[model samples]
Target: MLSSSMRHTRPRQRLINPFARATARPGAASSSHPCPMAGRGAATAAAAWRPVSVLDDWVAREARPISLRQLMVFGRSLTESRLISSANYVRTELPSRIAHRLRDMQQLPYVVVTNPHINDVYNLYYKAFDTFRKIKEVKTLEDNDRLCEIISENLKGHLTVIPKLAMGILECRGLMNPQDLDKFMNTILRSRISRRVIAEQHLSLTETYHSPHFSPGAKLSESDFIGEVFIRCQARDVIDRCARAVTALARSTNGPDAQVPAVHVDGHLSASFPYILSHLEYIIGELLRNSVQAVIDRQAKLREKAVAAAAAGSTTSTTLNAALNQPPPPIEVTICEAQEHVIIRISDRGGGIPRDELPYLWSFSKGPKSANRLENLGQVPRMAATMQELHIDELARADLKAPSYPTPPPPTPSPLQQPPSAATPHTPSQQNSLSSLTSRPPNLRLGMGLPLSRVYAEYWAGSLHVHSLEGYGVDAFLQISRLGNKNEQLTTRASMDAV
Candidate 1:
């Protein structure tokens, strides 16, 4: 059992948002007491630019009035607050290079951070936060419904920006000191914990708010208490959509009508309870894509051998063509539910991730092997979007609180874009893990898939892990916690001290 202190979650109605963070701009008004390390934070705070406010034009559409700017400020302010704090996160544990990077982040003027990806993430956050802050006013079902609409809109916006944000962060990774990698990793971990908390709170609140039978300040029914998450995820339907996405992607890469091996689930498709669908779609899509690619490559090789045999007079031409046309083995998906968790296993026979690459399966850094390619993380998402084309708008639809966000753009090759040859191609399981569903082939792969997926998987009380059999295949296990009311965020030092 967790301590009472651990169970303390930020109030859902109106979060105690720091006024200073209400705008991504640091010079904004103050709310919460000053930081404990005010002496250390003063310069960074002073140098921080005031957060920008969007032009608010209240427009009523479909009987719902949307305060575009307030929502925008809400999400961005939350992000800015976290990031501003993260800029100095675990200062004592970091070395100078990373520490400097963290502090420098606080000092970055809004104008200097010109990337659309960076800007969009903050924008979405501010919007979401603004909506979240208004939950207390949801005494009536109509108000709750309005709140849901705004929240969904912000989530859609999140899809448009997250990959870009991840890419932007990685662009400067090379400047990180080797010895301080752990420290940098810690910073990301904290950020992930914060994101998870924010997702669960708002998403769960959405479930309650959108329900026709829902009531404010009433005891939540046990049956409906998964808190708006991990509920009624149609595994069969999800598989169908993902399979279509995979097939379409495969055909486009190999041929307009190329017959890639289909994905085969080991059991009857089941509906999952309390799971985020978009994130699942991404995970499953990536696994199937790689599996299909491997089967296709294997079939091609078999055809090559058969053709050579035919020339050698050992096999008939007709038999060789028949052998060449046989469908590759289907990738198997296994879904199992326990009392407290939902587990999905995706198995593929793509000649398993190369043995040497196994250890780094979870890493995002461009190690020594691809040093000569000279591409940074910012370009990987664009490349992945270009080749495999996993971006789909349907995934952003708000059913179970709009899972994660939308995917990267379609795979469009351009002279400006560089393929992920800088590093070894990641597998299907990892390909769609966090970026685009596109993974490795003749040369393409989702460059940031595995690490990103891990973030999502671990965001809740869940896990994503890989088990590989070299020269045979790989199985990725994704676990989603079925329990509810987890700690919304990590504990702060101040909280711990009080405890």
Candidate 2:
């Protein structure tokens, strides 16, 4: 929890928002708008500028912890007065949360602070803090509208933050010990999750308030959303949905003809719980994708070894062909519902991770050895942003709520089947969005998925664990709290004794 206290505060200065200015020059002809070069120059100038004081008085303030039940209670009976109150609460609360995080970043060691990716993230936090700090109290509907636009833009701008932080930390792995490194990352990531919840929740509330179907004092169901959160989310539905989407991603990545394994969902199939939809989708999708990929790779490797042996006359051609033609085993997902938590186990026969890679499995630093070759991979993949955009099919993109999953795409020629001249490389711009599903090999393996998925799980007092059986397979256990009363597991400034 963040506590409020006043410190000696520096005089406030009016800040110029270059992005806003360049895009909103009043009464100027469209031709007179600043060119790209001019905009870049403005951005550079903004980047170089910082306030005299890094810690605002608000940094010491205390804010109440948010709970799922609280959100539902607030959302159920929203009137004009309640909306305005919510707006003001959000307006003040966001900066306070952001301020504390900014302080946490400020306390980092100089070496860690100077890492390029960390520096970029630090600047982003500062800009967001400053932007929110400058906004006058949001009291009216029009004021709330402007605040929503700012929130939306900031959310988009911070999409790459998780990847950037991971990359920077990976580069600085040696500077800090594993314990401190995990501490710092846990703090930052949990803070990131908290900030997004407040901003996104407010945005959703505003949207609901303005919807044509909205009535100020009418009865609203508990199922009525405060944001992307669902009060009574169906767990099995999310798991099945994410499984299908990840299957499509696998097919797209490994080529259309890839034999992606089927996902078998069992145990507590009708379980419902209160949770954020996107968060659940992201965690489940990442775990399933990993399992699916592992299955595909293991099967392919088996076929290769068998074929090589057959060529060496150690095995018959008939036996080799039969092995190669067999379908990979299905990925098994079992959901067990308990009084306080929902436990999901995803088991895959994808030949478990090697012993050497286990130490760095849930780390931001000490990523996969392949991470060193990131220059060829463009930027580290955006985890949160990409997860938000994950879909089972093209049609799902159009209607995320109540998604109508379209028929899976028909198989096309694999690279080996196609003529050599037919395969072209995908550019970074084309592969950035998972919606494209055309990422080049190695770009998708930054080693952030499982670690970040753990963060999302732990954010709600849930847990994720993976157990490998070496040559046989791997099992991932995910526990989510259905109670929805656990306060966010946040690290405060007082806890910043380490790196």
Candidate 3:
């Protein structure tokens, strides 16, 4: 059917198997037909089914940039037409972003690309990109409705992206340098954040548009929420909620008698701004959990030393009793509302981070040298599926549940009934048994906590900093921009491999 010139033209690289296989020759199935030649043809067909280069067409397409301020303005008075426009924007933007990541993966060294975890992630991204790029134009409410369904399904399908990416990087750590790995990870995570921001923003707007209470033309007040962005978000309220949730979690995991420290929140108690509540919860919750755990561990060490001294006859009963009864120092949180930002300081008196671990504190490519990091990495697939799933309330939904502790035995009826000394308080057996390295509870340690928190904070033009006092404690500073006018920082690096 082809013209002479067309038939003689050089063939384009067959990237993606778009066409079905050619049918076997007539009577090829009979005994007379050569089986080895047919098998060879099929093998060649399978080997040539490459699809990596096809993503370039989509990657060449540009993504429409979006900002938080724009989100708030558009969501303030969402209408049906606006909702449809948002849906289309998300549909087109997501594919471009997905394609970009796919290209980044394709450009990796063949060895790294072939890693099982990375290959699985590549397939998922390709599937999502293919499905999204196939959607028809949205011109009606019905069309938008179908697009929403598709978006939801895709979002659900990509839930394991974070863990899969982490595992892949860990496996390929030796194949790439630290700087290159960090850049690749930052690009992927930031791009993901941008995509989710638009996708979720549109979904929320659609929900608000259909709500009975929504009045498109009604004048809105500063107290109202425009989709997921709150016009006046209470900073302290979210911190308190996350603190309470973390406190409850600590007790349940450490045992009934665990000495969880109190978080003392002060300054600018009523400061409010336009922000996303879920984001605030995650950042604050992670920081607080780290602080509380540090304080608890510090106190436990002091108690153990006191008990050891008492056994060795090194101190008087008064001093020993004081040490035994001492509670964990309170964690202090100060909130400051500036003209254009909200700055929070979380100060804790837990023994500071080990000096050796400080350099890699915020580096995801190389975690601190500890067995706990590896254990936590192993649980990522079961522990975390999505950012929202990191919230305290969602902890129960994870498959790796915390172990239960038996009730502590009642005080000894008589001194003889107990061992040589009855004065020592019941040792925190459950807490001590759950070593950071061997514990089964995934919440206790996620190796990527500090790094992920930093990414989330920086995603919106904000920042997170940590200062450790070596043997004293740690102070964390979090800056949030209330203006929300900065564009997202997404990288467009083609390849990170060294020449």
Rank list by lDDT: 2, 3, 1
In model 3, which regions exceed 4 Å deviation?
1-50, 369-371, 382-444, 494-499
What's the lDDT of the predicted structure labeled candidate 3? 0.64
Leading candidate by TM-score: 2
Candidate 3 lDDT score at position 157: 63
Residue range 139-231, candidate 1, lDDT tens digits? 444543454455444433444443554543344344343223323333344343344333333443444333344443344221222322323
1-499 per-residue lDDT for model 2 (tens digits): 0111211121232223222333354322222422112333334433544653555576667656788878767877767788788878878888888777766654454345545576678788878888888889877899988988888778768877877777666666666676777778878888888888877777766666676666776655544444445677777777766765676677767876889899999999878788876677778878988999999999999999998999899999899989899999999999899999999999999999988888878876664573553443244454454453433343233222333211113221221110000111121111222232323342156566787899889988899999999998999999999888888777665556334
So what's the TM-score on candidate 2?
0.80
Error of 2 at 102 (Å): 1.6
Evaluated at residue 448, the lDDT of candidate 3 is: 74
TM-score of 1: 0.53
Regions more than 4 Å wrong, model 2: 1-56, 370-373, 380-383, 386-443
Q: Work out the TM-score per prediction.
A: 0.53, 0.80, 0.79
lDDT of 1 at 351: 66
